[model samples]
Target: MACKCGGYYYTLNVKASFDRDLNKRRKFLLRNVSVIRMFTSGFFRSKWRSIAGKRRILRLKALTVSLKALKLAGVHGIGIEVWWGIVERFSPFDYDWSLYEELFKLVSDSGLKLHVALSFHSNIHSNNGKGALSLPLWILEIGDVNKDIYYRDQHGFSNNDYLTLGVDHIPLLSGRTALQCYEDFMLSFVNKFESFIGSVIEEISIGLGPSGELRYPAHPFGDGRWKFPGIGEFQCYDKMDDLKMAACREGKPQWGDKGPQNAGCYNSVPSGVPFFEEGKENFLSDYGRFFLEWYSGRLICHADAILAKAAKILKKYQEREQTSVMLVAKIGGIYWWYQTLSHPAELTAGYYNTALRDGYDPVVSVLSRHGAALHIP
Candidate 1:
C-alpha cells in the first residue's frame, strides 16, 4: 500500500526520536539536526466522508486506544497535517481546525508530543479515481479563470496541485497574494494553538512548494509526460498567453515561448540525449543559460519571501513560550544526471545546480538567515 499526497508517495521509515538531552538542554543553536519524519494516516481519508455531509471521527474510542498504545510503546509523537484545503477550503481566512483540534487533544492526553506540518498542497486520486482532497476550492476557482497562477510545461498542460511559484506575490488570490494566503494560514495556526506550542508541539514544518516540499513538480506522475530517469520538463511557464510569463519572457522573444525542446525524455540514455549532451549547444547555449537562471531564480525568490514571513511569525512564538519551536522547510531530491553538464532534472526542479554553476548555495544561504533547517524529502 502507498501513502499518497499531492501526486507523490511516501514510505514511513522513522527509526528514532528527537534527542532527549537536546530537548532538555534547549540548545537548539547547537544545531545537531535530526530528520523530522511525518505520517498522514487513514484518518484524513475517512474523516470527511461521513453520511449527510457531516464530518466525524469514526471510531473515537479506537483512535484513543491507538494513541495510548503508541505512547506506551515509547513512540515519540505524530505529525498532524493541517491541510490548507480543509482548513480554509470554503473561503479565504476562514479556518476550520475542528478535526485537527480533536486529534491534537487526543495526542496531548496520551502524553505524545507533536511534529506539526502546515501542508499547503493537495492529495491526488487513487488508481480508482476516488480520492478528492486538493487545493482550496476558492484558489482552484481563480486558477480556473487565470491559468497562469499554476505551473505548467511547454505543452500548455498545467496542474492545480499547488499554486506555481510564478504567482507567489501576484495579487490574484481574491486580492491576496499566494504568500499572504500561506502566511495567514500560519498566523491562524499560531494564534489557535498557543496552549500546545511549547508543551506538546516540537516543531513546525512550513510547506514551501509541491507535495509539501520546496520544489517544482518537475517529474510529475499521472501526467503521462514523465517517468523515472527522464530529464523532466520545466514547470516555470503556464498555459496562458500575454500574461506575465511565470519565468518572465520580456526582451527575449527570440528565445521564443517554448522551453528547451531537445531535452532528454523521462527515460533516455545519457549518451543520445542532445540537450544534456556535452558541447551539444542546447543546455549550454545562451537561451538555456537565460531561461534556466530565470526559472530557478523565481523559485528561490518564492522560498526567500515565504521563509522571511514564516520566521518572523514563528520566531515570536518561540520567544514568548521560551521554547524552541523549530521551523522546517522541505526540498525535493534531484540527483539524476549529476555526472552531466546540464543536470537536467535538477534544473527543472528549480535548482540551477550543475557542473557549470552552484545553485543550492544561494538557496541554502537564504535558509540560514531565517534559522530554518532544510529537509530533503
Candidate 2:
C-alpha cells in the first residue's frame, strides 16, 4: 500500500518500511493487519478458545507488543527503569550522570523517548560488588555503608555488605547523611536532566527493590519498621532532623519547605531481601510478604506516585511546547509476574486473587488510555 502526502506518494510495507509521511498509512496497518495477526496467534492457534475471551486476549497482546515496540522505537513517549544505588552512591550534592547520559543519548539519537528507572541496587552490588554488573566499586567510599543496612535483616536477604564485602551481613556505616543525601541525589537527577527529562524522557521509575526471596523485613507498612504513612509519621533521625533545621534556618534548601509531606510512602513494604529457608513452604511464608506488598503498595501507591509526578512534570513542560508525552510507570510484578523473581507459586496465586479485587485490569486499561502500560512479567 501507499499513502499520498499532498501530491507525493509513499509505499507502505509492513516489514519493509514505516518511514511514510502520512501517519494514517501506519495507523491503518497497525489496526487492521498487525492486530489481526496477534489475535490469531494467541486465540485461534491456542486451545483455550472462547470468542469473547480470545478477543480480549488478542487486544491485550496487540497492546503489549505495540507498546513495547513503540517505546523501543521512540515512537511512544518513554519507559522507565530503576537504578537506586547509583543515586545513593553520589548522593547529597554530587551525581554520576554518565550512566543516565549514555542511555538518554542513545534514546534521543534514535528519535525515541526515554524513561529512567531512577535508582536501586543491581546485581553488581548484589554479588559482593565485584561482578560484571557491579556499581563502580568506588561508590563504597562515597555512599554511607551504614545506610546500606537496608540490605540485611532476619529475612536471609542481604542488599549491602553481601555484595561489597563478600559476606551477607557486615556493619559498615559511614557515608553521606540521610535526608540531605537523598535530596541531593534527587535534585541532581532532576537538575542534570532537567532539560532532557520532561522534554525527552516520558517517565521516571523509582525502584524500591524486587519482591524476591533475597529481600524482606524492609516491608514499608504491614510489618512495621520505617512505616511512614505520611511525612508526619516519618522518624527523624539526627541527620534528617539536622538537615531540616539547616534548611529551615539557612533558608537555602532546594526542596521547598525542607520537610516531609503528608503524602504516604511505600518503601517499607517489601524488603527484597531474600529468604534462604530450605523448604518451599518456609520460602512461601517468608516471601509472602513481598507478594502482598507488591499488590498493595508497590503496584498501587509507588506506581501511582511515579505516574502522578511524571504527568504533572510532563504536562507542565508540554504546555510551553504544545506537545505532551505519555507517562508510563515501570511498576512492580503481579502474582504470576513474580514467579520469575523466584516468588513462591502459592504466593503468586494469592497475589493474583488480590489483583482481581484491587481492580488491576482496570488500572492497566487506564494506563493504556494515557498512552502507557503497567509492566507485567
Candidate 3:
C-alpha cells in the first residue's frame, strides 16, 4: 500500500540511509548523468535548441549540486529552501539577479537540489522585517495606489489593509488580478532561469494560503509596535468573486474558482492566536484542517499549473540552448509551520505525514523515482 502523502501509484526509489554504499551510489549517478546528456543532446538539438541546451546545462549543474550537498551534509537527502521574499522582492524592474545567479551556481556546483520553500512575505519591501511578516512591499504598493479596493485602516495603531483574496484588484505588486500575479511570477521566474536552473533542479516545494492571505494573526498593532501593515483589513475568502471577475476581464482563466478553497482560518499554537481569543491548540487543530484541505485539494492543480509553466518555458529554452535538466514540484511546505520556530524537524515531519495521508508525494522520493526519465526539456 502507498503511504498517505505518497501521491503516485509508483514508489520513488530513495536510499533510506546514506551509509548503504558510497562508490556504488557515485557510479550509479554518473551513469545516469551520461545517459541524460546523450538523450537530451540528441532530441533537443534541432527543434528546441536554446531551451534544450540550457536545460541540459541546468540538469548537469543540479545533479552536481544535489550530489555535492548530500556528500557535504553526510546525508542522502537535505532540506533546501528558496526564500520567496528574495525572489519576488527583486521584481523584474528592480530585481537583483546576481545574488540568485551566484547562489544557484553554488547549489549546482555543490551537487544538491533544493527542496525549496517559495515565500510570499518580504520584510525588505515593507521596511519592517521587524514587524509581522507583511505582504511583499510591491503588492501593498499596488493595492495602495491603484484603487481603494484593499481593506484599509487609517488609525495609527492598526493601519494594516486587508484585501479579499478573489475580489481584490490586480495584485498591486504583480499588477495583475488576484492569483494571476502568482502565475505570471512563476512563468517569469522559470523563463528567466530556465537556461540556468530549469532542467537541473528536479524537485521544488510551494506554499499557498487564503488567496491573497500572507500570514495569520494579521498583527497590525500589538504592545505599541505593528507587526504587519494590513492587519485589521486582512481580506481572505470574502473576495473570490471579484478576483474571478477581474481575471475574466483580463482574458485569463478564472483559476481561483477551480483552486483549493480554505474555509475557517486557523491559528498556530506558538504563533499566538489571532483575535487573541482562539487558544493555541484550537488554532492548531482548526488551521491544520484548513491547510489539509487547501493543500490536498489543490495539490494536483498547483503541480499542474507550475509544471505547465515550466514545460512551456523549458521547451523554449531547450530549443535555444539544448541543455538537460528539469525543475519539478515534489511536495509543498505548510505555511502554518512558519510561526512555529522551535522544532522544525517535528513540524515538517508532522506536515509531511499529514500530506502523505492526504495523497501528496513526499518530495525526496519523487526525484529518486523519476531520476532516470527526467532530463533536459
Candidate 4:
C-alpha cells in the first residue's frame, strides 16, 4: 500500500512469513510443555519481543525498507527522534512538519505502532568540535552565555556543552516562562500530528535534559579533559546555582552568605583545594547530605517543569481527541558510578550509584505524579 503526505509517497510491504513464525513459536511452546519451562520460555520470549520492537522503532528513519524488514522480524513498533532544532529551526511558533508527516504516514501504512522521542539537545559531532546544538541558533543568541545558563564542567569550562532550550535561557517570545514555551511547543506538536496521535504514535518520550536523558550534564566537560578528584565535584556553580545556594543560606546565618563555598563546605575542603583529607571535621559533617539534597532538588525542579508541561499537553489532547497517548520521561542512569578515581561510598556519606550521587527517587516521584512512564536507558 502507498501512503502520501505533502508531496511525498511511500509504499509499505509486510512479509507474511514473520507472522507465521511468531504463531508457530507460540503454538510450539504451548504444546504439552512443562509449567516451569513454559513460564521461563514465555518470560524470555516477551523480553526478546520488546527488544525487537524497540529495534524496529529505532530504525524508523530508514522508511519503507525498515518497515518491511521490521515486519519480517515480527516487530510491530518503531521509535523516531524528532529534533526540536530542525522542527522549529526558522523561528518560534513557526514549524515545518513535512518530514515528520511523511514518516508518520509511512508508519501508518505499514500498520506499525510508533514512539516519538522529542530531542532538545544534540550529541552530533561537527567540524567545529563543539557538539551540535539541538536548539535553534537564534535562541542561543538571545541568552546570556556568560551567566549560569549553560552547563559548566569540573574545570569550570563551558565550551562543548549544549544549551538546554527550556532551562538555560528566557523564551524568545515575550510573556512566557521557559516552561510555558516548552508546553506550547508540545501543544503545537500534538496539533500538527493530531491525526496520528492515538493511531500510529502511541507514545511521546519527552526529552527533559541533555541527550534526551533526565539528569544534569554529568560529564559536560567532555572526556579526557579534567580528571575528577577523590569525590566528584558538582558542576552547577553558575550564577543561577549560586543564587539558589544563596536562597538556601538565607535563614541559616551560620552557613554564611556564600553557602557551601563560604565555609569551605564542598568536599570537606576549602575552595580551590584539589583533594579532601580523611577524618576532617567538614568531611564528617552533614554538609554532603545537605548539598546532595539541594542539588537533587534543583534537578527535580527542572524535571518537574518539563514533565508537568508534557502532562498538561497530553491531557489536553486526550480530552480533545478522546484517545489515550502515553508519555515517557527518559531518566539517565548513574554517570559517575564507574569512575576509577574513587569509590562513591568512600568519597561522601550520601553518595550512591546514581546521577551526581543524587538518588533517582526525586525524579521518579515527579514522573509518577504526572502519569509519565520512567524510561532509564
- Which of the numbered candidates is closest to the native, going by highest lDDT? 1
Stretches of model 1 off by over 4 angstroms after superposition: 1-54, 125-132, 239-253, 265-269, 320-322
Question: Total backbone clashes of model 2?
Answer: 27
What does candidate 2's lDDT look like per residue over 171-236, in tens digits? 232343322232344556766777775567644444333421112222333233333321112222
Relative to the true structure, candidate 3 reaches a TM of 0.40
Instruction: Compare candidates 2 and 4 on TM-score and give the better one.
Output: 4
Instruction: Give the better candidate number (2 or 4) by lDDT.
Output: 4
Model 4 local distance difference test score: 0.50
Report lDDT per candidate.
0.69, 0.34, 0.35, 0.50
lDDT of 1 by residue, 236-331 (tens): 457432334533555666565666777655556457767677664667777777777777777777888998998898876657556667777777
Candidate 4 lDDT, 64-180, residue by residue in tens:
675666656666566667767667766677676665676677767877676678877655432234424346554555544433456654345552234433243454344455566
Order the candidates by lDDT, highest first.
1, 4, 3, 2
Maximum-TM-score candidate:
1
Between prediction 3 and prediction 4, the one with superior lDDT is 4
Collision count for each candidate, in order: 1, 27, 65, 2
Better of 3 and 4 by TM-score: 4
Ranking by TM-score: 1, 4, 2, 3
Steric clash count of candidate 4: 2
Look at candidate 4 and give me any clashing residue pairs: 57-78, 57-79
TM-score of model 4 relative to the true fold? Answer: 0.66
